[model samples]
Target: MAGVFMISDHHFGHKSIIDFESRPFADADEMTETMIDRWNAVVGKDDKVFHLGDFSFLNREKTTAIVSRLNGYKTLILGNHDRGRSRAWWLETGFQEVSEYPIVYGGFFFLSHEPMYMNKHMPYVNIHGHIHGQKYEGNHYFNVCVEHWDYTPVAFEEIVRRVVPSEEQ
Candidate 1:
């Protein structure tokens, strides 16, 4: 089986993210197509992908359609923006979202959309995306949108070794 992966804040139909994020694509369609292509390139049919939040800017139908075209089964940790969309809407898109979760996989904590405030959960690194790669700092954090326009699902091990330091590891 392929390795598990996680990504977030792909604002797929938002043109402003290109400038705001210094994205490589010119527009939302180009961004979406490229993201899908890139995802398919690395992700296999059996690979599970966690999309933390902000999946799209368009309506639920458009968002769902785009998600359906992508590879892997997506588990969504819904963002504040997703609250407007009904639960049925998200379910139809084949993604699961929750307010707070404590799922342990890949030797890391998967808390989507927002990092925890307490340090008591030391070994449990919180993976989240809602700040859009700006003005945020904490322990064991990484942004997928930093060096690329397309989404790159980073493995927790990379984040731990690179950003968190060996002492923390």
Candidate 2:
């Protein structure tokens, strides 16, 4: 079945991220292509993908071309680094939807580029990215950063299973 997936911090065309994140790639070009390959490997042409943030640092033409090469219907939740262009620009670049702020999903999950304050008592889970390589210690927080997920998009069902307590399972 086609699935809903999530991932973040692609940082396409940003060479320094390879060093900053200690990614196992030779350069930005390699990093970008490898991520694209991994993305296409798991995502189908009809899948829906929510990109949490920091999608890319490349110019509009390059970014759009990259998006065209990937599978799935993409949606963007603006990240700190995504401010260089407006929401319309992102939409024009191939993201079907672009959000300026965090959004609620499935009535119980908070989706955002950055982690929101969530606790077990709050009746909500935060599925987010942006603190790559680091994570908040709690069941209510789920980090979808590629750095934490083998540089692949994670299935939404997988995230939901994590939010469901062991006792319930």
Query: Which candidate has the top score in lDDT?
Result: 2
TM accuracy, model 2: 0.96
Please identify model 2 stretches exceeding 4 Å from their true place: 166-169
lDDT of 1: 0.68
Model 1 alpha-carbon drift over 4 Å, by segment:
96-108, 135-138, 145-150, 160-169
- After the best TM-score superposition of candidate 1, give how far the Cα of residue 4 lies from its true spot, in angstroms: 0.6
- Model 2 agreement with the true structure over 105-163: per-residue lDDT tens digits: 88888899989977568978899999999989878899999999989999999998887
Cα error, residue 106 of model 2, in Å, equals 0.7
lDDT tens string, model 1, 92-165?
87675443343555666655676545474566566667776563456655554423324667654565665565
Q: State the lDDT at 155 in candidate 2.
A: 95
Candidate 1 Cα deviation (angstroms), residue 47: 0.6
